[model samples]
Target: MERRLIHVITPGDHYSPRTGSAVPTVVHGLSAHAPAGTEPTVLVARGTYPDRYTSADVVEYLPGTEPGRWDRRLDPLRGALGVRRASSRPWAAALHDQDEWPPSVVVLHNAPQAVPLVDTTRHAVVLYAHNELLRTYSPREAALTLGGVTAVVCVSDFLAERTRRRLPPALRDRVAVVRNGVDGTVFRPGRRDASAPLEVTFVGRTIAAKGPDVLLEAVALMDRDDVHVTIVGSSGFSATDPLTPYERRVRAAAEGLRDRVTIRPFLPREAVADQLATTDVVVVPSVWPEPFALTVLEGMAAGAAVVASRIGGIPEAVADGGTLVPPGDPRALADALQVLADSPDRLAAEQDRARRRAAERPWSVVSAELDALLAARLDGQVTA
Candidate 1:
């Protein structure tokens, strides 16, 4: 019997020093909970986690450009110029130098360009989607690539349904809804302060799509001493880029209650989990169709009541753990928070429910599910 390896080819920082993206976080969880004897190696692009500090884990760093070079917008360029998507070709060749041994399962996280390039004959290729399908690839092109894919594992059923609507109906069955899971040990529910004001939190990439501005407006509308806000993470258009006027507007929006709100860049996972643990309520006011709000689930796991946008896969992911508001509506968000803040009993009840919901999607269980799914799709059969 040959040893089977589970390779995770991602283009972001793994959970070593830090994690700023959802796919990396999910990938870290998958690697952490892989079944026994299933050797997991995360193949991430070079410079994705700059400074080159290696962690004691199953990570294989490959050649890649600087942080901003591998943007999804480059997908069209690769297709037009016949350039391969992933920069890990040299590394892959090195790993397969033996020629006889290949990774049994290759889960490509948000690397659409690697789909067609992957040799599906030797390895079971799982297309792990962390975002929308049409955003990077066209319907016909995406459907065509489905021929080589084993399973289109979407983070939420919402993403699965959205992708199915774009692809051929026959390929719909290949779509699977494996909702994102959290490390239960790291993100368990904690005691909340009953006397303190309702503490609200929003954590993600500090972009306009995440709706930090909308959350600010909703907090301003509350106009109460009892409402607190904390928005963490960064977006594009950094200090060097003059093209970002939206960030300027975001700074201006905080002028009204600067003292009441704490808006900072991304923090370490422990710091984030700590914030979620102490928080009374966590808000996800995404203006765009979010594939899945991992922050919402993490907040729920921390026993905090979550208030999020009802669009995309959030409603499905959230289930009964949180209250769903219309996307981009500050007034609706304000109303929901105010109602919860005034009623501690209701807040506590939701917290209990949220914790229970999170327990159902622990990383160990989710990882086992993924391992089973990928193993069954293998071209070569095996028995323990």
Candidate 2:
């Protein structure tokens, strides 16, 4: 049987050094799963150009201008305009022209702006919604785009359920849940120095939803000399924007403990494994309902005992591998931190379980399952 071609469309700003974005991770994982003769093409919206991925069969750059302050203030209006503009670009025209590829399937990764382009093409379309866009987009916009998509694949049951409730009845039945996986090979346990202080790391953008403030507050409450926390990633896009209110609070909370709490810019993806390898524990105190906490998975894969909020898909991701505290509760987060610090044996055992759990959900396994889904869809063997 001739292998079918799969075209992936995404609006994610790729090529960044950050390792936590689910879109790139999913795209990379899916590429690994491409059938023996199948070709997988990834299309990303242009940003500050990304580093080249040698493994990708084809990486197409699409044009999109950055948003201005006014645009930021009026996000919904601007986002709609941006999507409409993006849809008319030459890149989108090129994509539309490629209907000749006789693409077996089209996978959209949160590119509601490109829905019209895909709709014009003659291929089975699956929208992989990573976030609850219904909450972000107007009902009319959601109905026009999401309603027309053939299938919806959500990363977590929470997102699936939430999306289902907002979607038109016709689209609700098409939604499915497919959890993201981690690359276990790169994120395995590392050698730890017993003499080192209990080091904790928080990775991701310094945003309000991530709840960096709660982490700082919890660290401040602990006030332990032996505990160290490192906050990685940029605080704000520009000095004018400053850090978010929550990030500012986090900074303020870490005042006296400043020496122990380190804030650094985003690190390269290749370097993240090494950083996670050395850490004793990783913290993910997100205030919002994260659809799927990819950082938690990466942390667990690195064999660090993960301490995350028990909200959204985080509990599903952590499962029995790590500890969970209620979201936005400094006391609970502090207690979890203290437990890990006080009991090295418990931490080690949790790390062992995390390593085992991560090993079972490797990208190869995830990709194979995706390939099967794509093949089945192409052969008319499966229905939404």
Candidate 3:
């Protein structure tokens, strides 16, 4: 029997202390829990920093432009132009050079242009959409890039629907929804001191879009000394990256809370897990339309009562595990936080619900679902 080689491509650099994006984290989890009999190898862009996680074999590819603020700003423009997407061609060629054996499955992450770059005639190609990136492609461009792709896996139902809407009707059936998962082993609940003040934490990029400021504003409105909030993260994944004006504004808001709030720079994955484990309440106050908030699931997995923005796929992720508040509304957030802080029993119940909910969606389940999808694709069977 032939070896089952699965090439999992990342959108950019893999998980490193300096790389703060969720894509690498998700990749690491999925690969770590991958199904038996399948070998998964991750392909990442060459970076100065070493990978933090070694769950799978990783190969480096030289991307046209490294992940940076300027590259992110120009993504829409690059996606609009079909020729510009050719930057991933080198990555495609490297696929063949990796080994003597060909990959049975090629999983492309986020980059639509790379879908057509793969030799679909030989390999079963799958496009994993971590964001609503498909909407940026023109109809013709979408059809061309996704023509021979076996499936388009979206991280959330919200993202799947968004992906379908952007594609031609004929190609929409190929879209599949596979929500992101959390690693319970690392993110499981830790000891929480009931005697201490309500521990509130906001984790993610500390930008206006992520609503770190909104969290600070909400905590300020409560005007209660019994609750403490910790804002963890930076403008980017690298601690060395200069703080943006938005980050500065968020810090300014935190300053008003004085002893009530503690602003910290971005930490590594393990540190993030540690931060989540200790918190009583985790707030995801994203002001923008978040496709899905990984922090929401992570917080829940850590046994923290979650209060998050109800916009986009967050409601889907939170479900019955958390309290939802209107995005960017400090008063609403304040009320939600105050309710939990006022009643210890209520807080404990929320925490229990969150942990239970997280247990039901472990990384193992996600890996099994994705494994079945890949198996079906290779067997010429279409999965919904």
Task: Specify the poorest-scoring 10-residue window by lDDT in model 2.
Answer: 85-94
Summarize candidate 3's per-residue lDDT along 185-257 as a digit string, tens digits: 8887888888999999999987789988888888888999999999999888866689898888878877877
Model 1 per-residue lDDT tens digits across residues 43-118: 6555555533232144445554432456445756664455544443443532342234454666777655556656
**How well does model 1 score by local distance difference test?**
0.72
**C-alpha lDDT (0 to 100) for residue 168 of candidate 3:** 92
Go through the candidates in order and give each one's C-alpha lDDT.
Answer: 0.72, 0.72, 0.80
- TM-score of model 2 (CA atoms): 0.85
Question: Which runs in model 1 stand beyond 4 Å of their true positions?
Answer: 1-5, 15-17, 46-61, 64-100, 135-140, 236-244, 379-384
Which of the numbered candidates is closest to the native, going by highest lDDT? 3
The CA lDDT at 360 in model 2 is 73
Local lDDT at 232 for model 1 = 71
Cα deviation in Å at residue 195, candidate 3? 1.7
lDDT, model 3, position 64 = 47
Residue pairs with backbone overlap in model 2:
15-50, 187-301
